[model samples]
Target: MKDAIEVQLIDTNIYKSKELWQPYRARGAFGGQSLHAYFLLAGNVDRPIIYTVERMRDGKSYATRMVKASQRGKTIFVCNCSFSTLEEGITLSHQVTMPTVANPESLPSDLDIFQKILRSTKSESKQFLLRAEKNINDNSLIDYRAVNQYSNEEIITGNVKTDAHGRRWFKTRGALNDDMKLHACIIAYASDSGLINVAATANGLSYNSESMGMMASLDHTMWFHAPARADDWLLYDIHSPRTNHGRGVAFGKIYSSDGTLVVTTAQEGIVRLTEAEQKKRRKQLEFENGFLGNCRCQL
Candidate 1:
């Protein structure tokens, strides 16, 4: 997680990314590492990203900042963030009940699943696995274990069942310092892990599927409701409520092991089928229309 979010201060209210991390076959850097900001745009991985922070507002209890990320003088992303001081005492508080799920210890790490698939005898499967392996960090700082397991074949074929909802247990691989802000940043990074994919999975599309043409986040918002440790096991419960046209939206909640609702997140992104898939759908529609026309004439 440290490597994923490392940044160097260049000037007052300006920071530059020390390194950029892009997902397998992604057009731009990962969105989560840009912590506490919205991804208004995306750029390729060919250059370093510079972040400029604008102090929008400052008050005794509330503050706001606007962040713009750019590459080669072109703005690639912009986000508006607001912060609030912790209240001395809670006046009112309520959260929806956290769903019961299997413990993290009972599930296999995602890397373990990837390695098991790498031993497959099928050549096509092996090739796909090789490419998919790039998505996993070699020396990962975070541990992820999916609650609902799926094989690499199922994922590649877009046959894995998500029902528009998914759950995973995640945490930093090692203990982190007792900095609440740092922990929040770590959670921010992890939040983008597979959020937009939840929307695609609702339409039976996976990032690994040839039918999936594009999947990229357009905007992300996070609300920190309470303090939580990133090193402790946390449950990320996510669901996609809608996907229409070329966009999909998903909502997620992060809960501590003891069921404390720590954060809420929302994201929307581009989700589209490949041209081949679109063409196939068109042909099928034409065939159905022709068959129906003949039946009507006979009637």
Candidate 2:
């Protein structure tokens, strides 16, 4: 939730580069820009490109393209996307239904929750301190929340379980009225938040200041089944499938109120660790969880 991108269109007549470039900070590339560019490029083609996609996948047709967003040209965010053919081929259909969750109105806003958490802390978890330091100062179009989170320092020190799948509560915090496409694009922008952590969770590792290295999103994927509004609250259900060979795969489902499946996402990331780092982490985990404790397993 901390890293989800938020953009508000200043003009309805056109979307600009700043709007497109903002959400892509998760990756080195700009996702909003790519989405804008994708729309622009598709508009230029002669054929009618009817677009449709599943919400999440990994390396498949509907997976990576939907999430790997970039800026269109220098200003617009174009999601590099393709339209589907209307041809009636081998009829195949299957899907996972959306889960039932609390309504947005029933749940506290992320900001409220964050403020409460900060106020309640006594010992001052280092991980929370780091997150506050890195994120508290920013102003953006969208508001994101990690539904259940420990501080960044707690995570690295093995004070918390890395496999505790993250839940990010999010929505736009502005008055801008976004259309279906704009909302979908915004959701795409926000979907990247906490995706990489699924792998880290499995390994009981965290990105601490003392550690030397890099953590970045390599590729992202998502699918939109039905229309969704970014201005409204959405519950993102995420999980990790595998973590091995210095890499991890994670997937998620976005559900609207009344349990409608709006979107899905999948991501693969590079999780590099030298033997020394792994040993250090193992030692830390052992010290926290105990000598016989299962550091690699979590609830």
Candidate 3:
């Protein structure tokens, strides 16, 4: 006899596109699968997001939902997630070795990193910088620290060596109540931050660069491997294997500070820049520096 595994498909649809607006569904998937678990398990909840149930199926102890999400009027994300009634079975699994890294407290927080970056980028608009500074200093629900020690000046100057691997440690800013769904959603949102940057850093690009005017996530996928608290420091180990055609793909493995492998994620993003844009941006930076250089100088 073989160990039993159940699978189900609920419903499906094929949508058509119009010439006026961009077609949906065919483009990308949505976020909020863990929250969907809340909606399903709790059975009485309300959310602003619009979910069109693509499929719903249930077995004796498991249920699954394929959800398409939209906001305002656009299909933003989609996912196929399953939940199960707890059952006991033989359990055996293996995880890759967790990398040795510095303590989260010893590393720099996102606020620290942003402030350092702002110091080096004083040539940018003062209004924009003030807004960014305020956003970082504002009380927040998440705390993040970079495992690698690299300064903003070194990066923006393109004088630092880019590491192929990166790690981040994060936990909730405040204590979170014991809710599995809430914890999962928080982690999902946070996962999007570093993966794209890993690729950009390797290419010696910063999000602040004018040459890279636009960047957007094309698709994202996360798999919950084991239960972990979002409010506890979680280490996200990331690597980017490929970047081409204005796009880059990154893969990540998330481990709890205790060494439990909690989740895995992959995302591909569109990072577009043309040679003309680079040339134009270089001239702009040069002119701005020259103009500011002659103005009553202070450092």
Question: lDDT winner among the candidates?
Answer: 1
Compared with the true structure, model 2 gives a TM-score of 0.61
* Tens-digit lDDT track of model 3 for 1-299: 00001112333443321111111111222122232221111111122434566557777876777866455566555667776665679777899988999989888787777676776666345644654566465554468788866655544443345665778998877777787766776787677776776777677665545456556666677777778888889999999888887888788999998898888888888777757887887899999999899785764
Prediction-by-prediction clash tally = 0, 34, 6
Instruction: Supply the global lDDT for candidate 3.
Output: 0.64
Pitting candidate 2 against candidate 3, the one with the higher TM-score is 3
TM-score for each model: 0.90, 0.61, 0.70
Candidate 1: list runs displaced more than 4 Å: 32-37, 40-46, 120-123
> What tens-digit string does per-residue lDDT give for candidate 1 at 1-299?
66567788999989988777665555678752123455656666667789899999898988888889998898888888888876787578899988999999999897777666666635365546666577454556679998877766675576566679989999998998898878888888788888888898887777777778898888888888888899999999999999999899999999999999989999998898889999998999999999999999999
Q: Candidate 3: lDDT of 62?
A: 65
Could you tell me how far off, in angstroms, the CA of residue 237 lies in candidate 2 after the best superposition?
1.1
Q: Is 1 or 2 the stronger prediction by lDDT?
A: 1
Window of ten residues with lowest summed lDDT in model 2: 39-48
Q: What is the lDDT of residue 74 in candidate 2?
A: 28
